[model samples]
Structure formats: C-alpha cells, structure tokens
Target: MSIPKRVAERITNRIKQFQSILDAQRARDVSEADTVTLVKDLLSEVFGYDKYAELTSEHSIRGTYCDLAVKIESKLALLIEVKAIGTELRDQHIKQAIDYAANEGCEWVVLTNAVEWRMYHVLFRKPIDKQELAQLNLLTIDTKQDECMERLYLLTREGFVKSALAEYRDRKEATSRFMLAAILLHSGPVQTALRREVRRVSEMLVDPAEIDKILRDEVIKRECIEGEQADAAARRVQRSAEKSIRRASEECEGSEANPNPSESPPVQDAH
Candidate 1:
C-alpha cells in the first residue's frame, strides 16, 4: 500500500477502534487531561514522533504544564492544549498556546478537546511581535465523520501545513500593501483631490488615443497634452488671484489718499 493509503487506513482503523470507548465515556465521568493524553499518545504513535513528544504536568520557565510539546531537530515545533469533550474552546485556550509558542519560539500551536482539533500558525514579525495567523479545524469526531476526518488528515499532512504557512505570510504582505496604499491615497482632501484629478486626466488621455490607433502611437502625445492643459489651468488661476489682489491693494491706497467724507472717523471717548 502507498504511504497515503496506509496513513488513511491507519487513521480510519484508529478512529473505529476508539469509537466505542469514546461513546462509552460520553456519559461516564472522565477527566479532560486523560482524554488529552489518549489523543497525544495516538498522534505520537501514528506520526512517529514518540521520541520528541512530551506531556507536561508541572510549571516550567516556558509555561505552566503545556498539555504536549513536540521538538524537531532541537527546535520546538509544536505545542498542544487539551480540553474536555464538552469544554468550549475559547480565546483563552488559544492565547495560552500562543504564549507557549512565543516562549518556546515554536511555529505551530494546536488546541484540542480530543474530539476536535484546531491548528494555528505562529506568525512572528520580530522577536517580540508574535501572533497566530490562520487556524484550521482538524476533526469533528462528534459531528461529521468521513468529511471531518479527511480534513483532519489533510491538516496533519506535511504539504498542507507548508502551504497554509506560505499563504499566511502572503496574506500578511498583501494586507500591508493595501493599508499603505490607503494611507497614501487618502492622506488629506487636497491630496485625495490631486490623485483623483491625475487619475481622471490619465484615463481620459490614454483611452481615446489607444482606441483610435492600432499601436497607440499618439498615447504619449495625448498624455503630454493633458498635462500641459492642467499646468495652464493652474497658471491661469494663479494669474487671476494675483490680479485680484493687486486691484484690491490699489483701491486701498486710493481710499487712504482720498478718504470718504460720508464715512466719519469716530472721536475718542473718555473712559
């Protein structure tokens, strides 16, 4: 059997073998930590990470008893947090795993309740700036059966994790570019207006010339014309404003020399 097929079969058999145990424990009282241990053991056995996987039950410098930790080549690669079957996984759980990842400089975090697993990528922009990037829902052992398991296996696959991490990095870069463009394009009203005017003129100038010519030989010439027109308009406005100001100043000088008799100067009153 191929590796993929064997992996699938192994997972299927594992799920089937554990199904009855899970069903029996549904009504019985059982600790979440125990369930987490079962899952950790299963994963370690199946994935051949037994040597690197460790279950923490005591506080360490990195964190207080992380459910499980996996090391690869002397580097912490994965952190896991386990909850009970009915326990609601919340931001606090994710935050705790994130904190562990930060301390250990790990790249992956997993939050699970034995039945369902969520995988997160630790995105680090710098030594201090670390965050969870994308989360994948791995398994829904209580709900969907085949579909959820397939997705879970896909998440666990080596290629899928690499692709997801790459996509997360790309998405961050694209978001940064969008924010930068927004800042530059909408800095102020004057800047906004200027960009709009420039874009409008560019579009108008380029469209007709390209539409008329096969090779658009006149496109550059048309753009030059549009630019000249804009410059001329600006100069015209400047000239008109200067003329108005000069006229106002001359009128003020004439009024000072020949004061209007009808407009009386008030006499100073004793305070």
Candidate 2:
C-alpha cells in the first residue's frame, strides 16, 4: 500500500530519531517501565498518536493490566505488551499481548521492547490464535527503504484509520503457504490440472488418490496439511469458491431472464 508522502516523511524522521534513543537504552539495559516510556514516545512521535490521550499505559483487561493500549477517539485500536530493552521478544510475550486483545475484544496487538516491534492480528477461535503480521527492528531498519517505511506506516495512526494493517494481514494470509497448500490439495480445477499434467508427462493414467496421497505425504509440509490452521484455510477457500459460483449463477439467471436488457443512456452535462 502507498502511504502519503507527508506521513512517510514523518515516519522516516521519527524512526531515525528513535534509533539513537533505542540504541542508548539497549546499552543501559533499560527496565520495562523505561521501555514503555520509549514505546509511548514512539507511538506519539512516529505513529502520530496523542501520548496522553491515545496511548494508555495501564490498560485493565480481566483484572490484569496490559502495558499499553492505543485508543483513538475512545476506540481501542491496539493492545501492546512491552519488555525491557535488553529482553528478547518471545512467543510467551506475544501470547500475553494476544491475551489482552482477546479479553478486550481487540483484533490487533503489538509486542515490542522499544527496539524490535512486532505486530499481531488476533483470531478469536475455539482457542485464541494470533498471526504475526510484521516485525521491524528500529536499529536495523533502513529508513530510506520503501518497504521499511510501509511496514512502519501500518502501525501509524493514518494506517489504522484507513484499515491498512488489516488489509496487509489479509493480503499476507491470502497468498500464505497454508492457503496455497489447501488450494493445491483440495481445489477441483487444480486436481484436474495436476492429473492431466502427470498423464501428459508419463503417457500413463495417474489415479487421483495417488496424487492426493503424494501431496499429503511428501509434497506439502505436514503443518500446512494438518492442524487447525490448515483446516481454516481450506474452509476459507471453499467459501470463496462457493461465493464465486453463486455470483456466476445469479449473473446467468439475469441474462436468461433479460437477454436484451436496456442500458441507461448517458447523461448530458448542462454546462
């Protein structure tokens, strides 16, 4: 997604400014509280959030407090869990961040140590799940790179208002390995094409079951073919196919009913 030049400039400038502060803080092994302070400052200066009004430090959720929350116009945008500058961000930290988001019915969460920032999209399913959308290290990020700027933009106030982050997550999931594996394995057209290609190459009949077995057993990763995530991806593909079929059916019926439907005449401008 293309970010506005003005906003991109601010993000570039702020990231450059914060890189030095984060580097010094990391050298001192700053405390979590100090890290939160830096994060809040980043949110305000870089992300265009009001430090006092939009960034809340002690956000309560289910009798526990998350380190920081980004709330704009009284709407909660993100729940963040901060770690000390010296601490490495881990799965446990993401779990805690997603837990806060899940409890508060928030869809987004962030885990950061004022240097490395990780953004997650929380999925509220049978058990809460999260997908890491973007991870950027201020120390290593190149402010001049368009990709780095775009990644940082998704966490900014303008990006949140424009739903860029959610769009980015959707785009990531749409072409994800799990989604591709599910489509390759279960899609009818894909299966037919595979069988046809095999027959063409070998000049022999290949059973569908054999192809399926090979895919399930050897070709695709076990994680991509097995487990809850795989199941969800398959369901999503099925739903998309179903919707396309329905739309085509409706269009066919319309054409059959009104084969020569009249088109609207163009309106003339009254200049």
RMSD of every candidate to native, in Å, equals: 22.1, 5.7
Cα lDDT tens digits, model 2, 1-271, are 9899999889888788878888899999989999889889999999899998999877788888889989989999998888999998887878877877888899998899988999999999968998889999989989788888889998999999999998999899889889999999878788899999999999999889999999999999899977888998999888888988999999999999888779766799999
**Deviation in angstroms for 179 in model 2?**
0.5
Q: For residue 27, what is the lDDT in candidate 1? A: 50
TM-score of each: 0.49, 0.89
lDDT of each: 0.55, 0.89
lDDT of 1 by residue, 52-103 (tens): 3333434254436777666544445577787876676776777777777777
Q: Pick the candidate with the highest lDDT.
A: 2
